[model samples]
Target: MRLYWKVVLINGAVLAVATLLLVLGPFSVSRHPVVSEAVVLGVGLLVMLVTNSLLLRSSFKPIEKVVAEYDAMFERLEDERAASSARALAAQEAERHRIARELHDDVGQQLTVVLLGLKQLEQRVPPELADELAALRESTRDGLDDVRRVVRRLRPGVLEDLGLPNALASLANDFAEHSSASVRRVVTPGLPPLSPEAELVVYRVAQEALTNAARHAHADGVELSLTRVGDRVALVVADDGRGFDTRTDGDGLRGMRERARLAHGELAVTSSPAGTTVRLEVPSS
Candidate 1:
């Protein structure tokens, strides 16, 4: 039987028995009852209250068990989801590292060779061909630089080598150079140490937030700050520009959320007409 119906039935049966005893039993209350009669009525009422309590408790046991089971199930599912996300993110990073290595070792080297060949050929070429060769060499140099930039973005060797603080500072410099926005970077000294996963999550989230500020928000000024908050390290990126709705889930926002979940960090975004702020807090090592 459903819990609601079972409770209703139990309560109704208890009330019916009490009503019958009151209406049909030998126990009668006078308008002005004697002390013994009053004591007897009080004891009966106490017994009825005890009986009702026992019945209701028994009826609710199944529901309580079911709720406990559901709670455990949900907890297990959440753990599994987090594990899956971690695995996927790790694989993605590995792939990116491999691609960056190949680009630097193979494609980047080829471009460098071509640029050098063009430089050598420029000297030997006739006067009419000199301008064309110079332009071609410049284009080749630009392509090599572009490849190097892509490798840098894909691998983030700076993060691995210099740690989170310097990595973030580099990111801020890059953003300022590439975009119209002026960036202010603040990294608190002696911040708590973070696990590698936590550091990566923080870096990626900061990178995405700055990219959004540049590309979408058209922010003139951006601030990136990293500090220790209680036992956790916090990263905040704020911009002064037209804000976006936080309710929307673009690819970048979703990726940030997934990374935050993998690191067991908290991600919060507050946006208004004036600007937007993205904050991430991760446990310290």
Candidate 2:
């Protein structure tokens, strides 16, 4: 029983014993009624105190066992869910890498051959057809550039070669080169290393945030910052464009959340007319 009920039972027992002693006092063995009553009351009080103390301690023993079991079950479920999420994320990344490789190797090679053929045709063609050949060559070149950009987006080699910080700088530089928007990166020096999965999460979150700032927010400039905050690392991407309400989760936002979740981290987004800021925090551990 719980302590509350135990105490109530003990009190009731003491009261009943005292009432019995008083009711039978007229036939008591002691010579004086007052002395007999004092002795009975003293004995009853002592028994009540001892029983209450003993029962209170023992009552919660079962409760402790139940609570411990519940805690263990909760942790087991959490670990299973985390494992499932990690597997899903790993599969997704593998698929992306495969697609990137195919595009770069198969489709990209075909486009290169087309460009080379166009160059040869331009040299051998008559002067009247030169303009058409030139136009075709230009179009093919642009398409090739687009394909390369898509391949880079799918699989960034810089991320594997130079680590996350340098990879982020490269991403920002590419974004600036392609878009009119200015991108500024602010990174703290000597940032602690992260697990590969954690690094991917941080990189993807920043990439998506920048894409939203350029495409959805129509921002002219973006600020990306990575810093150490005590025992945690924080990534913040902010834009200067008109922002949308963050209450809705678009595909980009959902993707960011999934990445953060798989990394055992959290993401927070705040938006206003002035701009939007997406922040990710992960434990240094």
Candidate 3:
């Protein structure tokens, strides 16, 4: 039977017995009827209260068990989701590294050979067409440079060789050179060494934040700070520019958020007309 109906039936039986004893049985044995009836009524009420407590406990036990099971299932599902996201991020990084290597080794070498051949052709050509050949050679060199930059973007060698701090420093330096904005970096010394995957997530989040600050916020100045917060490491990127609404804005913010989640971290972004700040916190171990 349903828990509610079971509780109701049990209480009704207790009340019915109490009522019969208080109304009929007590009267038959009583000489002073008024006092005896009062005493019997009080005893019946006390018995009813005790019986109700036991019945209620039994009735609610199954509901409590079901609630506990549901909570356990939800926690398990959340753990699975986090693990899945981490695997996907790792796969993506591996593919990017492979493509970057191919671009540098195969495409870059071909472009270099083409540039060399062009130089020889320029020497053979007459002075009348020399300027045109020179321009073509320069254009080819430019294209080669572009390809190399793309390779760097795909997978930076510094990230693997120098570690996350130095990689971020290099990124900041490059951003300062390319953009009209100024970038200041403050990295805490003696930080706990993060796993390579976690480092990559942090680096990517910082990269995207800087890109958004320069491209969308049009900020004149930006600050990137890394520090240790309790058992976690925190990376904060703030810009002094018009801010964007995180809910409605670009995919760059969303990408950073996903990367943070995959790293078993948390990301918080706050924006206002005065400025914008992006912070990432991941466990330090």
Using lDDT as the measure, the top candidate is 1
Cα distance off (Å), candidate 3, residue 261: 4.5
lDDT sort, best first: 1, 3, 2
Q: What C-alpha lDDT, on a 0 to 100 scale, does residue 236 get in candidate 2?
A: 97
Off by over 4 Å in 2: 1-64, 126-139, 161-163, 173-183, 189-196, 211-222, 228-234, 238-285
The C-alpha TM-scores of every prediction are 0.77, 0.60, 0.75
lDDT of each: 0.92, 0.85, 0.87
RMSD values, in order shown = 4.0, 7.0, 4.8
Worst 10 residues of 2 by lDDT: 24-33
Total backbone clashes of candidate 1, pairs 3 or more residues apart or in separate chains: 0
Query: Residue by residue across 57-108, what tens digits does model 1's lDDT show?
Result: 9888888999999999999998788779778998998899899999999999
Question: Model 3, range 16-93, lDDT digits (tens) per residue?
Answer: 987787576734445656876677657767878998888788889999899999999999998788677667778888
Which scores higher on TM-score, 2 or 3?
Answer: 3
The clash count for each model shown is 0, 0, 0
Clashing pairs in 1: none
